[model samples]
Target chain A: MGRSPMNREDTTKNRILAAAGPIFAQRGFQQATVREICDAADVNLASINYYFGDKQQLYIDSVILAREQRAQQFPFPSWSDDTLPEVKLRKFVGMLLKRVVVMQTIPWQVQLLMREILNPTEACRQLVEDYFRPIFDRLLRIVDELAEQPLTDLRRTQIGFSIIGQCLHYRFSAGVISLMVQEDQREECFDWDELTHHITEFSLAAIRNLGSHVAVKSSPRTSETH
Target chain B: MGRSPMNREDTTKNRILAAAGPIFAQRGFQQATVREICDAADVNLASINYYFGDKQQLYIDSVILAREQRAQQFPFPSWSDDTLPEVKLRKFVGMLLKRVVVMQTIPWQVQLLMREILNPTEACRQLVEDYFRPIFDRLLRIVDELAEQPLTDLRRTQIGFSIIGQCLHYRFSAGVISLMVQEDQREECFDWDELTHHITEFSLAAIRNLGSHVAVKSSPRTSETH
Candidate 1:
């Protein structure tokens, strides 16, 4: 009854999500307007209600769409393959950084996700658990295997943050980063290749240095004193 | 005349900023309303209009207030002391992460700053540059010296991201992180000490490795050759 190869409901829903991607990225979920999304998609305001049931659902769908796109573009290879753990770790870091930065495939979606992390909405909570959390867990496992010791959940989570943070910082704060580096010669600007390399190497070293005792102790005292 | 301070303008401005601090941390800048701020401070709404001129300015003042507090905490002596680079770096990472995670000293200003970074109002542009950028640049230099290389700006920046990402990821995604570690037998789920150790080691290794590059350049037009 809908268009060929797609249900009418699914097609309309996808269109709404696609339209929301950039707006949410550009202006956070708090600021994005439903009317603007409808206008951008060239669909009736009622289409959102019919397909997804609410504005919040549309946003969740948009986040899912972006996550799928990122996963596809940077497909997670089986670490079961013969590559060394370090090499596998490096390649994964490279692929992630490339997809996250050079591609800019889902810039706004990523920003929206960050917005949720910084200031959670009910919608962000749902998507983060179902979608991003699993991927992060798996990635942490991979890094832990390459690491000197098995990590505590807290350590695993911290490593996950480090890898992602290094890769996404420039893209997430492109304007601020550009300004910060403006005084450097034009030839010395940030490059994706070099950026990925540094992140891979730095993160690897940091993980390898984590002691075996990390899983047992929980102290408010900082590592800075060392 | 203002209540008690020598300078009435400074008193009023500081009061407005002081009131704005917890409100912004709790509600975020966009969600924080002027009336709520006025009510909390026990000051007239007109005073805000009179002194800072607008809601955005009050927000900036609050951010600056928090930033100044943090800057005063991370003194240059922390880095420039006779301690070895690795020791200094670990200490710095631990100190910074503790400050970010503890929630009392620095508050949640970092999250607010990051949100503004993602979605900047004109007011935040200069504030970010003035407060955060220089600190990051200093971080880059510290990372560079630790690595013992004349790192390219790209390399330094990448390492900078790694350190921060590793450090801040736990607090930023506390919801997911808490869940990830909740199953552990440890009575206190979030282990700050262990997290700091893992991140410091991971970051140090990554930075150390950046100085050495071993990847062979492949021919641009080769069909396939190892």
Candidate 2:
């Protein structure tokens, strides 16, 4: 009897989190209500309060859970010891595009993260520290390796942003893009492989061309090592 | 007396628009209320109904006005006959970064537009057609000039998005960026001139490197002309 009740409680908690992710993503923190979340979850109104303490707590928990789920679903591509920087970059860009644009199976997590980014609330701080910072650091390392010259941290960061910005544009402004392009062009632009290829090619060309210029001011570390 | 009353009415109308722009931008269309707007504007609540027909109309008018104001404030740089494609591209990127990141005197316009983009309402379609499309078309023309070989319209559009995506990232994710970079690096990154130089160099290098590849599959027009 005790085990049955505990399992039921766990089920209700999981259900509430699943329901809350989409609602909070769609409505944002200020607009989403606990009642709506409970109704969507098919749990009693009191269940949220019992399980998560309050609506804010539930929202935070839901965001964290969604981040974990997304990371697992589209984990970063790992490079082997012999992998070339160019190959690693292509894979990185492809993985990022997949995470942003092609993952139609579970889009709520992306939507939720985008919503937080646009209209950030308290949970945004945690989301950035826990979820985004590590990914950013990894991207920086990849960019550093790709550079022919030792880049200033600032330069590396800007390059990383440029690459990420291209991928994110498709997600945030798909409607605007579709409206701007010709009807036929829209179909071509949205093709997953085509868009990924364009971005990777575009970024690689820039990185290769600019890498020499960036190395113009060699770091002390380079001189010392040489 | 007739002109005076008319001028007073016009003043009242403008006041409502100015007040509503920030509110609608901050709270979005659904959440922003007429009463709050009236309170902020220090106008009679009836004035909104009397002047603009409804809150939606007022919101639309404010958006239009803000767009006009922004365009006038930061008009796109005009290229001379003697300007090189490389120079023009650099100028275009610099001007765009200025429009997006440096013009902080009045940020409400950018914020309003971004909010509409993230959670597009009916207003977004008109905004894109009237405001964004012209700018996009201009960008396409610029990108076309920079390419060694003629680019497909779709390729031109993707390149434009890539350029714009970099500029918009700073505005939308300033918080996340500030968190990611070191405190001193943040200061350097946000320096309008330094950031503009970096983005321009980054984009130009990429465009130059990718231009030849983009021309590999010539469009029907190229074949026809040849």
Best-performing candidate as measured by TM-score: 2
- For candidate 2, lDDT tens digit of each residue in A2-106? 344553355888899889999987777778988899999999999999988988899888788778888998788876788877777767777787777834443
Q: For each candidate, what TM-score against the reference?
A: 0.79, 0.89
Q: List the residue pairs that clash in candidate 2.
A: none
List model 1 lDDT by residue over B1-226, tens digit each.
4365453354656677778888887777778888898888878888888988888788777777766666667554354566677776777676666666644343666656655565566656686578667667667767867866576555566567667765656565665554444465232334566656656666666555445542222222311111
The true-versus-predicted C-alpha distance at residue A119 of model 1, in Å, is 2.7
Native RMSD of candidate 1 (Å): 4.7
Provide a comma-separated list of chain B TM-scores, one per candidate: 0.76, 0.85
In model 2 chain B, the worst 10-residue window by lDDT is B217-226
In model 1, the Cα lDDT at residue B97 comes to 68
How far residue B101's Cα lies from its native spot in candidate 1, in Å, is: 2.4
DockQ, every prediction: 0.41, 0.38
